[model samples]
Target chain A: DVKVTQSSRYLVKRTGEKVFLECVQDMDHENMFWYRQDPGLGLRLIYFSYDVKMKEKGDIPEGYSVSREKKERFSLILESASTNQTSMYLCASSPPYLATQYFGPGTRLTVL
Target chain B: SQQGEEDPQALSIQEGENATMNCSYKTSINNLQWYRQNSGRGLVHLILIRSNEREKHSGRLRVTLDTSKKSSSLLITASRAADTASYFCATDSGDDMRFGAGTRLTVKP
Candidate 1:
């Protein structure tokens, strides 16, 4: 079984704070994705990385950045957290050519 | 937009009955996958069917894909109360990925 683990399950931060969310996948998948799950809006992609140090913006990448320094680790960074950034964040990984993604447990961030 | 759209946003059924959810997409896809997300959590991959495949099954889940119609359907047989969750269909157009709004299914006990 593949396991994807997130650094935090829940977090709270003040406005304009910098927030970091980390994800690690044991499967060593080549593709990693970050998404924000919101009510009514569903899951919208934030950013995706195909390889180490390579990242691409998804549908909703504003105010968010990502880093892939290693194969098993992916990080999501919020430059300046705002109340609108409060939502459930999900991290997923997939094999090079496969579309089936294995997701982490998710981090619910609350911006005050 | 490449985002898929699921029909019948919400459905409630009694346990032991079958639950069906449908998904339709706008663009050509290489494959379509179904995922289930529990309340306040991440999604779980349920099944995947390629564009060339018609139907596939796993456990009590049945998935059917029709490329001509750009649609897919998922059927859960003998559903249980634990089956209550939001079901999403994601489409893969080569390197791009998009997910639908999802159908919230409630299987009453």
Candidate 2:
């Protein structure tokens, strides 16, 4: 079975603070993605990395950045956290050429 | 706007019944996948059907795809209380995958 692990299940941060959410996969997948899920708005992609050091912006990438220094890990960075950024953050990984994604337990973030 | 849209945003059914969810997309896709998300949890991949394929089944779950109509349907037979969850449909358009808002299902015991 594939395992995707997130660094935190819940987090709280003050406004303008920098926040980091980490995700690691044991399946050695080549693609890693970050998304924020909101009620009624659905799951919107923040960023996705196809390979180490390679990143691509999704539909909503504002105020967020991602790092993929290694294959097994991916990190999402909140440049300046704001209340509007408070939501559930999801991390997913999939092997190359496969659209089947394995997701980690989400991190519920609160920017107060 | 490659995001798929699921019909009947929410549905409630009695156990032992069948529940069906429909998904419609705007663009062509390489494949379509279904996922189930328990409350406040990550999504679990349920089934994946490629564009060329018509129907596939895994246990009690049956998925049918219609490329010409740009639609797909998921049927869960003999639904149980444990089958209650949010079902999302995703479209893989070769570049990236886009997800829908999802249909929330509730199975009454």
DockQ of each: 0.68, 0.72
Which 10-residue window of candidate 1 chain A scores lowest in summed lDDT? A35-44
Q: Which residues of candidate 2, in runs, are more than 4 Å off?
A: none
List candidate 1 segments past 4 Å from native.
none
Highest DockQ scorer: 2
| Residue A108 in model 1: lDDT | 97
Worst 10 residues of 2 chain A by lDDT: A38-47
Fraction of true contacts retained by every candidate, in order, equals 0.64, 0.69
Docking class of 2: medium
Mind giving the per-residue lDDT tens digits that candidate 2 earns over A11-37?
A: 999999999999999999999999999
Interface Cα RMSD in Å, per prediction: 1.6, 1.4
The collision pairs in model 2 are none
Q: For candidate 1, give the docking quality class from DockQ.
A: medium
